[model samples]
Target: MSEWRIYRGVREPHDGIDRLPDPPPWRDFELSGEVTPFDRHADALGDRRLPRADAYKAEERTIEAVNTALYLRRPLLVTGDPGVGKSTLAYAVARELKLGAVLRWSINSKTALRDGLYQYDSLGRLEDAGVARELRGPTNGGPQVGERGDVVAEDVAAAPASEEAHSTDLGRYLRLGPLGTALAPYALPRVLLIDEIDKSDIDLPNDLLDVFEEGMFEIPELSRVADKQSEVRVRPADHGARITVVHGTVRCHTFPFVVLTSNGEREFPPAFLRRCVRLHLPAVDDDERLRTIVRAHLPTAAEDADEVISKFLSHAASGELATDQLLNAVYLVSRTARDGAPSLDRLTALVFQHLNVTVPTES
Candidate 1:
């Protein structure tokens, strides 16, 4: 039994992560004593996506695997069927550890590595340059003089100076994505959820290897201007917030706790798998666990949830059904049971339908 766990799975906020031992030499970043600016978006305590403290019940194995990933400073690759709590695991860990916010990067087939890193608004910058040029007007025409013999057009030069500064401001055109924000040099590690990596392009997994190992990334737009301006303030994934990037590079003082989820949609490359700690979440098959989950989300309906759970288990045994379907059935039954609704049976039938099975309908 592994008792040296930092994330205890109890859903109570604690600083046990402070007790974690130093990382292996190969994984050490050596960026100690760096100061991170206060980010209200990352430090806020309330998140609607987080599971209720009293309702989520994580298995012992899940606890051990998370702690292992934390100690090793590696990402956790969670594979499981739908509704198996794979994605929710990241939020659970963030909530329990008092990690500010869970930065999420949702993946699709077109999602590239840079999509998670940062976005540069080149087109916007070009448009701003055009506006600045118009404001400066033509220098070819002789300077327009005022009624008192002062050059009014010369005053135009002063105005466009501010516009030229605005046009060349690289920070206004660049914003850090979720992955980039997670790599900011925070004293406490941020929780980063890379959801559905299996849905990404074939090369995306390979592209992330360098970033995961190095704990830093460079922005080319800012890099080109590094000679003139070494520090630039840019927005993070969280709106209305700004962070300073020095020398066009963003590095982590503390390695972030990363969770990559998959729906078993596709296989990953062997090299990519080698760097991540893996965890497979089995389906929620136990009757007691189902009740606990229901109670956590909807306590008022839990008293009569036994009957719904039994039917849910019976349907689950025959075909694939998500845990949320069970919760839906329980909520509807508890709400409509007092009315003696005659359509209760039909409603439950629709709620518990197998995900993989298709039923014929009338034309």
Candidate 2:
């Protein structure tokens, strides 16, 4: 493991990321050591319950693929069945290498490249502008007069400055999305999980090629006003965090470690595939692997899980069932048994149902 692995997947967090060699010339970016405080978005990113570092188990092939992607500074396209740890792979790598929270971009049918990059609240800005205008009087330059014909001195004094401040504050309405947050100028690369790419719009994969190739993106709103305001500080995808954008552009200090998961729902273009390192995760069918996973996640139930595991494997042999489903069954059975509840057989049956099987209705 010491020979070539930068990310040793033994479920132990380490500073091995520091040992990573320089990337290929084309992949190198200017380095910045500036540190910024940020709140981790683990909960919002849907990885709040990540498996304990001491519990996750990674296969040799998966480790090699991760390292290859890391050294080459390319995205890893992981295709596998649901609940087979495709998304968890990103979390595992981040845990082992001590990378900060994983930035996730979950895709849906309507997901576009910009959805992962940044979002500008133009409507919010416009509404704010309207409020500012109201604060200033109808005369275009003075405060509103009361019914008694007296001047509103406070409104007059505050309105012009408030309007000026709000009009120039573009950062208040702009935010960097997950992908954009991953490209922040950090000394160490952040781990990024682009989940379910197969569900994205047709053009998204091709759209990502340029960003992955150049390691930078531009915020058009900021770009247009770069001369007026050379720098803008905006919030990132993570909560309560801020990052600075210079000249309306963001260039990576290091290319993020990107993992794109797919469920084999669609095919990607050859050109897009050319830029990614592909890895296919094999199904977890063996009892030893299943037991290891069970122990990792449900240690209290490990002893009682054997019978449940056997039943799950038997059912899985005939139809599709996720690994999580097995864990769910084992957890319930173990809890019920301790509570002096009824038969484990019935509980297992309810929990281990096949995912791909559909029930027929009688007319």
Candidate 3:
């Protein structure tokens, strides 16, 4: 709800620390739409159900890698097991930097590089064209030019010719995907979350190399008409936000702060790995993580949080839980218990239970 602040108290000394650019080198950007700071709308940065954005407990190494990526203009490749706070890192950076809402591109087995760049609604455009043509004038039922009918040539020419129809404008039907939107020539670099990229097809990671290197891409659909038109307004990834591009190409003014997260489901190519600033996220130190979750969410249950966190850690030892599970357990204890009662063993067992682990039956 408030402006997010990153805790730099646990700062780590990184290579080339003294040489880091002030305000980053890539600050000269062209604004495509309204420029708003993240603090102005911090509530929309992440899922409201989970208040994890403000409580991102970053260690020295991650912050260093993030800075290195920013300075070098390389994507930050964050690898970790499920729920180790890999995806959350992007939101954290965007919130800290006052970058607008993070553009998220979720990956799956069928995902490809283009899936993140743009989505062309060819069918929708065609359907809309048919409707627009009819609205302009009756397609078949119109009488001869001299004959009086529901639609007349003069009326059609005078009324519709002056108006621009979305169907006729190919750019109108175009929607920039999260990646493409982030690449728009905005004054501030957008935070892009390439979530769970390892789940994508093998070629997906390789396919992004060219676009990443070039820092721009062309919309072939719009390019076809670019010879006659210099500028075209198209929809960006953000709802209701449109960007105008010269010659139908979207180039990044400031290379996007790309945070690519992988759950270690698959290995990337050597070439891809070389271009990225890799960060492996291990499970956070228990005491710190516990304190973070408790302090941010359940301050009332402070006295009993350590005991609850210990139970959660014991359950997580079997490799079937996530950090959020501990949060859930702690939040529940904070709510269900009024007085700091340590007699929540049964509740902890229920909350922290992993489905894969066989629970002993009553004898």
- The candidates, ranked best first by TM-score, are 1, 2, 3
Measured with C-alpha atoms, the lDDT of residue 289 in candidate 1 is: 91
> How well does each candidate superpose onto the true structure, as a TM-score?
0.88, 0.87, 0.78
Q: Give stretches of model 1 more than 4 Å off.
A: 1-3, 32-34, 38-46, 52-54, 139-161, 338-344, 359-362
- Model 3 C-alpha RMSD vs. true structure (Å) is 7.6
CA error at residue 273 for candidate 2, angstroms: 1.4
For residues 1-363, could you state the per-residue lDDT of candidate 3 as single tens digits? 111213142222112222434433443344364442223244363566225656666777887788778767789999986767888888767665556577899989998777888987766655555566666666443322222211112222322653334434667667899999888876556789999888888888889998887788888766756775667877887763577777878887677889999877778999999989999998654776667757765666667688878887787787577667777777777677477655578778767777456878998
Candidate 3, position 86, lDDT? 89
Better of 1 and 3 by TM-score: 1
Per-residue CA lDDT of model 1 for 15-110, tens digit only, reads 777787888988887574445754423435556676443356789889988998999999999998888888888888877777767889999999
What tens digits encode model 2's per-residue C-alpha lDDT throughout 182-238? 887767788899999999999999999999999989997788678878888888886
Runs in model 3 lying further than 4 Å from the true structure? 1-50, 135-159, 163-167, 338-343, 354-363
For every candidate, C-alpha RMSD to the true structure in Å:
6.6, 6.1, 7.6
Residue 212, candidate 1: how far off, in angstroms? Answer: 0.6
Please, what's the RMSD in Å of model 1? 6.6
By lDDT, the best candidate is: 2
> Using alpha carbons, what is the TM-score of model 2?
0.87
lDDT of 1: 0.81
